[model samples]
Target: MAAKTKKAIVDVKKQFEKIAEQFQTFQILNEEGEVVNEAAMPDLTDDQLKELMRRMVYTRILDQRSISLNRQGRLGFYAPTAGQEASQIASHFALEKEDFVLPGYRDVPQLIWHGLPLYQAFLFSRGHFHGNQFPEDMNALSPQIIIGAQYVQTAGVALGIKKRGEKSVAITYTGDGGASQGDFYEGINFAGAFKAPAIFIVQNNRFAISTPVEKQSAARTIAQKAVAAGIPGIQVDGMDALAVYAAVREARERAVNGEGPTLIETLTFRYGPHTMAGDDPTRYRAKEEENEWEKKDPLVRFRKFLEAKGIWNEEEENKAIEQAKEDIKEAIKKADEYPKQKVTDLMNNMYETMPYNLQEQYEIYTEKESK
Candidate 1:
């Protein structure tokens, strides 16, 4: 047997084992869409709540439409946003139009909220250069497919915002899986060090592409990871749109006020598999778990709240959904109207001055196409 170690006082902050269990998840709506505490809810007019719900419905429909498009061979590699409407869509409503956005792949919904056209989003998914073009007025970058890359890149954008003395912030998002990357910590730490005006959101969807949260992280809570960076960390109910919007709105205020970065960990669930064509969630999570989360559906709860206020009904919902679908259809048609992509576009845009080898490759491709 080894020598026994002496017992000593423990630092509360370092006790990752206890923190996850102790952190109270901030929530505004109950499972049935009733208010848990009316006083605690965010102040929103009845019209505002309806608009919010409309967007959530649009997001869900868009996800379904994108999947259908992919199956029809009209789109390419796509991430399903079915279960994350509240976290990604509602949080976006709190952002200033001028805020710089660097988003992860699943965050196309947010990019749309930031002024990216529906057709452009479709174009990007189809691997077109037009997809990368955002109207210059919209201060955002195209979605990053590389895991955890947006964290550091957004940090750089946030630094620029801070340096320019603008009253804006740079916001970015990642998933629980992305939280595992070293760039996650490095970016947050760098932002914290520089007091960069940034907001880093981690949508902790419980499964990192089939790996349960228990396996993805040993930390009690992902928000606690921010403790190391000397910034405020918050845990919000990602299933509650009101809660998400309130949390992000407050974080934006803090960032614009010259406060450093914030790391927000949303306790959410991704209802679908990792992607439309890849990763089967069935092997990792139980159907019972899915059923349980379905009860907490953000759309249902928010609709109930709106119904209570006499601002929404089933008929209105159907019309909004139909309108959203028609809008998507029109946008897809516009995207298809774009001329077919050329080999020249692929080789010319990669660099300001094409390297020697790339030039030769470009010439070879051009010659072959001509022949």
Candidate 2:
């Protein structure tokens, strides 16, 4: 007879600790603007490198102008994107036009680059219905506001793409806080089980509003959570555009090749409050922490790398900034020219044939407007 075996007690916490140690933080550039991992650098051409830097700079300027507009009551429901340029833009830079983008509320910059016009983005911020309208060729959904909802939706979109025999991927983003939601797990697990082509990115910017990442979960890293779903997970230096681009490009390739989904945790930081709706970062985060993250600013890091290559300079950056300002000015003017949104507008767009109850309400609202 075989020797009787005794059950072994498993140390769950220690196992997780060891598991976390296996996932390293991927980086191509250091905080000092030096290439630390030259081997992992993306194969971007000189022009492409400069273009990445240019988009990051333009996005920074856009963030600044958006904050000003929010303060002046010209914009609504604004989420500041000052410190997430590399994580947002560079990953998007890796995607092709055929890939579908499912964005969170903070991902408007990516949507804009993906073909949504600046005026439409402004309108969306102001809660106008027309903002939902997109160009016929654009393959993106509106920025999701209900936190982790986009994660589940992205899984569906990816499944749809696979069923159609399309060689494209679906990508979505959420914050560190969003990783805590049940939908996040459901989305990744479903995609992994079915081998759906999807990319899930968690922009771990240290906080979910006021709660820090420490309070969110016990897992050592968000990326490691992908293991349970049978997919690869990676943690990338979000401040390094090259690293983000490389990681995303690899993930996209794997996805289209039927390797399923990837979970990317970008180690980045936000330099402002969660939103313009009366939150304060000082109450929760320290000034020293903010300063430390500022040292790793994506724009500064990428600009340094490009300057070293003789591809970017102050003059080029200034031109980009000025162009951003002019474009924002024109978009805001267009938004101002739009007819004021009304209750009737919302009801009219609810469906092709309104129900009896809805039609009655619509007529009542229409009569009130006429008066």
Question: Across residues 1-371, which tens digit of lDDT does each residue of candidate 2 receive?
Answer: 99989766998878877897878999999876899998888889999988888899899999999999999999999999999999999999999999999999999999999999999999999999998899999999999999999999999999999999899999999999999999999999999999999999999999999999999998889999999999999999999899999999999999999999999999999998999999999999999999999999998888888888888999999999999999999999999999989998888787788888788888988999998
- What is each predicted model's overall lDDT from 0 to 1? 0.88, 0.94
lDDT minimum window of 10 residues, candidate 1:
14-23
Residue pairs clashing in model 2 are: none
- Return the top candidate by lDDT: 2
lDDT score, candidate 2: 0.94
All candidates' TM-scores?
0.94, 0.96
Error of 2 at 176 (Å): 0.4
Off by over 4 Å in 2: 1-8, 11-14
lDDT of 1 by residue, 136-173 (tens): 89998889988999999988988998889999999999
Query: Candidate 1 regions off by >4 Å?
Result: 1-5, 9-22, 368-371
